[model samples]
Target: MNAYGSYVEFDRARWAALRSRTPLRLSEEELQRIKGLNDKISLQEVEEIYIPLTRLINLKVRAAQYLDEVTSAFLGCEPVHKPFIIGVAGSVAVGKSTVARLLQTLLSRWEHHPTVDLVTTDGFLYPTRVLEEKGLMARKGFPESYDTKKLLDFLTRVRAGERQVEAPVYSHVTYDVLPDRSEIVDSPDILIVEGVNVLQVSKGQPVFVSDFFDFSVYIDAEEQEIRNWYIDRFLLLHRTAFRDPSSYFHRYAELTEREAVERATNIWETINLLNLNENILPTRGRADLVLSKGPDHQIHRVFLKDL
Candidate 1:
């Protein structure tokens, strides 16, 4: 191990060299469909970076299954089936959604053809009314802003082999949890859970969101880079989704470009930056893998948790 005791680091060239004979399973079109707003990842990057990363994850999944069987056999008990859970964490606009989606697509193409599911922890955030009542509207992405009990219960049921589990759905257009609807996740072979706070530990909570993860990843970027990405994304939303009459940010559509940018900068500075510095950044070392990105938003290094 290097001086970073927990992880052995690899630069892009070395990390990309870890790619085995695993063939690329995704096309550029499919990748474009899954790519997040303002996050640019070329097909070449997928081949060099993500494909190799997915291969590593596949190895871990197989190892985990073997351990499960061996442990069950040693205990002379029947093995209970459980999905391999992956936690993907990062700051807002750090391209975590893209990573989660890409992994889901690639992992599903493995020889075993394991069923994969993707869920974002945004769905677990408390409703706007609830946040308003608690006077936490401005502190929205913090740990306390989530309905921790509900999220914990959902994961508990998933790990318990419960089928047809339903989770609340949050809409970006509405910017709130949909009261009348939820998204159902049947028992899957793999579940990718992504969010800004997936790796966070709550002080009084008995179970952390990461406790259920078989493997976890933290997407890393400098604070200023993330801040710029967030503002850029905000501007993009203003021109597109924010222009919709039903959008929560529709009012922003009318602002001058300068005003919109100013507002986005303010939100990033006051809200997202605070959450990242105080909560998200502190949890980076806890991840099983860390993908550090350059200012261009391309992953430049990998840090694998050393056994």
Candidate 2:
């Protein structure tokens, strides 16, 4: 292992060796369904990168449970059911959602944690109407655009082991929070919180979002690679989702290929790139583990915080 600051860095081969014969529990079809658009993830990628990562996470979860149990017995109180929380953070098109889903699936299959739930910070974003009113429509996905209090309260309740906790839902079709809809999260063995802002530490807030995370992962890649991925995703959406009449980006479907590419590039430069540089990238060092990807969209290096 190569020591760098507080982390121990491992190349792909070294990291893959840590799998320790952990059986691959995922099928190809399932992997396809879990991957995000324009994100390249294969069964081989799962074996080499994610399987070992899941093994590490499984050990962490078991240890946490044991510690909690021992502490409760020492305190002469019944052990409370507390789900292990994992936070997945990355830039807009860096495949944060895909990683989150993969972890949720793999972690659940371990049998010790069969009920894993996945939640995205997208659900906590303010409605488009609210954003427009606050003049934050252009700043959507920025920290100020979220309902942090509501998100904190939701996380607080979940961590408190409250039953049937509800979180607000957002719709990409309308590009807004669904006023009448929410997701009910019952007590589970693990909850994977995924989003661009999962690791953000807001100033003046006594409790930050990352405070609720038991484990956090940061997906890392070179800025130019991420920009290209974002553009590719946008173009794919323009040819597919943007063509749907109800999609928020339906107007983009009418643009010529050149115009679409120009629009996507402009948005990436003005909004996504700015957010990544100013806010998201700065938080990478705070993560417990960093998965650095190569231009091929596969994790090439793993930087894990030393205990």
Candidate 3:
């Protein structure tokens, strides 16, 4: 295998060849629903790439279960059914959300793990008022913008196999944490956590967000490509979602197309790019798997850590 730190590298062709007898379970309509705004993922990509990836994850799940059982038996305790948690981390506009959702759907379809739940770290971000008070209004996606203690506490509870744990809900339209709304995490067989900062280290905290992850994936792509996609998505939102009076970005929607694009580019260059370089990209090597993508937003290579 090709080398990448302690990982094995596989080109798209080689990675595709790993698929074996995994059924093509999703339809075009379902894919359309799963895809993020302006993101492209064909069914063939799922068959050739994600099918094998999910198969591998299932294997890991079974292995984890066996280890848990053995450990419990050795300690003279009953087996505790702690759910397997998978963390998906990436730069903004890299399609980590889509990957996380797809994996949740695919893994849930398997008999071995039928109760997959997906949660995004967006829900952990501080409220707009809090951010404004903290003077982090423009750094919304950065690690400091999140309520790290609450997020870590939630994950700790999940790791202890706690049930009925509720997560705060964040709205993209309003760009703030929803008031009095939460997503309950029942006893799921598997949980997928997706966000830009999932893999990042929380300074001065002993328990990191990634500490609860049984497996993790980091999506990789060229900075320029990601920037272009981010701008495109921003423009699309400006024309549609941002046009709503209730949208946080309604002011941007009023700008001319050229002005809107310029604003998006400036945000990317100043905030997103800086975060990607300093924080997100630095965590790539720590992931269990890295899905490297081309300018087309399609995964072209995979790097799996040596197991």
Candidate 4:
């Protein structure tokens, strides 16, 4: 299907109406935090971009449950409920983390809903040492650098409702996958997997990462705008968090402001932008929904599969 179209301009009012009739998950505290960090992405964006999304996902979950009940009765057995998996994918600076975090809070607070778990594919990244040993350090965010087999196994186990499963952790400050630590997943009613390549196609002939997803979303934006956002975020982090002596990026932080800006721009142009174009952007069409963002870093278009 020819899903891509020229970007149409619209005002916030249109967005609000289109995204109306949905519930939001933000508590006053969470709303304040989001508001403080993201002036561009506000409560309105959540109402428009994420609220309708949650409603769609909730229906998907309830439908899956209904199917289980039907199948169980057909087989003369009790219903077997499983967690609903939602995979959110996008470029590095696309705010997918916020999406996952928000959904976790909202989905859990839904009347009588079970716990919602959030995980990132970063946790499944090969540890720095492993990547270095395998000659994949330069290809860090690329698919080849990941332990795809292990990630698949983790999802397979989670889908089957494993009693206790541990997911390796990644430290943003260190900018490395942790070698010795992981987060434990007790079963939850819902699981949200967010990352640049979370929805990537599997190389195996018979199955892939997407095979495990009940629903998937692609956070979309123009290449130039995304690149700019990445650079902006890098600069912001460098001036703030990166200044901490204990920060893993402290060495970069110690550089002259000009030097740091040069390095950040170069990395954005060479690594992240390249990865998004080569590996991630092509998969946007694969998502059940595509949230196309404009220069302002707010959603401008929503392309959903016609049911």
- The sequence of per-residue lDDT tens digits that candidate 2 reaches over residues 110-180 is 97789999989999998888899999998999999999999999999999888999988888887988999
lDDT of 3 by residue, 1-307 (tens): 4534789898888988888777888999999999999988999899888999999999999999899999999999999889999999999999998999899989999998999999999999999999999999888899999998898889888878899999999999899999989999987999999999899986677778898999999999999999999999999998899989999889887799999999999999999999999899999988999998999989999999987
lDDT of 1 by residue, 152-222 (tens): 99999999879999989999999999999898888888999999999998777788989999999999998
**Residue 245 error, candidate 2, Å:** 0.7
Give the least accurate 10-residue stretch of model 4, judged by summed lDDT: 1-10
The candidate scoring highest on TM-score is: 2
Number of the candidate with higher TM-score, 1 or 2: 2
Clashes of each: 0, 0, 0, 0
Which residue segments of model 1 deviate by more than 4 Å? 1-5
lDDT of 2 at 124: 92
CA lDDT, every model vs. true structure: 0.91, 0.92, 0.92, 0.78
Whole-structure CA lDDT of model 4: 0.78
State the displacement of the C-alpha of residue 238, model 2, in Å, after optimal TM-score superposition.
0.8
What TM-score does model 4 achieve against the real structure?
A: 0.91
TM-score of each: 0.96, 0.98, 0.97, 0.91
Error of 2 at 236 (Å): 0.6
* Model 4 spans with C-alpha error above 4 angstroms: 1-25, 34-39, 202-205
Better of 1 and 3 by TM-score: 3
Give the clashing pairs for model 3. Answer: none
Output the lDDT of residue 293, model 2.
94
